[model samples]
Target: MAKELSVEDAEKKARELLDRRIASVRTLVTARQRLAELREQVADADREDVRLYNAALNDGWSPDELRKLGLSEPEKKARTRRRAAAKKTAADAPGVDHQEPAPVPAPEPS
Candidate 1:
């Protein structure tokens, strides 16, 4: 014979499950934030490595030596046509202020 649960007991069981689910969601949010922080730290480390490599090169380090140290110049990024078009459109949009100053015209040669 199966026992029938009272309404109060059923409500308590439901509340417990809801509490567990809320806790799991909170844990998930915390884990996601930690992952984002870790990614940023990795990006910062990459930038530091590039800066150090540039400094070493400027100090007369040979490319071969740099390669031996597992260092290389950062690759130039090539923009796709779609991205270029979007960028140009954005730049040409009204009320958009570009950070770069307008080009100064060179003085006429004497």
Candidate 2:
């Protein structure tokens, strides 16, 4: 026959389980944060590579050589869209006339 645990012993076991649960939750939170940081680092690296490729192009690097770096088409498209959005935002500045004027009709040529 097993002996029943005393109240004090039961309380201690409950506290221990609670502590373990708290530690597990903390570990899980830390792991999630680290994963997010790693993902951000990867994105930053990709942007850096794109910037470097642009610089090399300006410095007369061959397109074939740049292509060898494994930049995918989707990545290029995303970069293009990002650049266009940035330019649009900049052009839509406060107090600036954003609307284009109608094209002036040229005088009829003889």
- RMSD (Å) of each candidate, 1 decimal: 16.8, 16.8
The sequence of per-residue lDDT tens digits that candidate 2 reaches over residues 1-110 is 99999999999999999999999999999999999999999989878878877888899867776667764322653334334444557668888888889999999999
For residues 61-103, write the lDDT of model 1, one tens digit per residue.
Answer: 9878988888767654465665444455778878998689989
Provide the global lDDT of candidate 1 against the true structure: 0.86
TM-scores of the models, in the given order? 0.59, 0.55
The segments of candidate 1 whose C-alpha lies over 4 angstroms from its true place after superposition are 1-5, 72-110
- lDDT for 89 (candidate 2): 70
TM-score of 1: 0.59
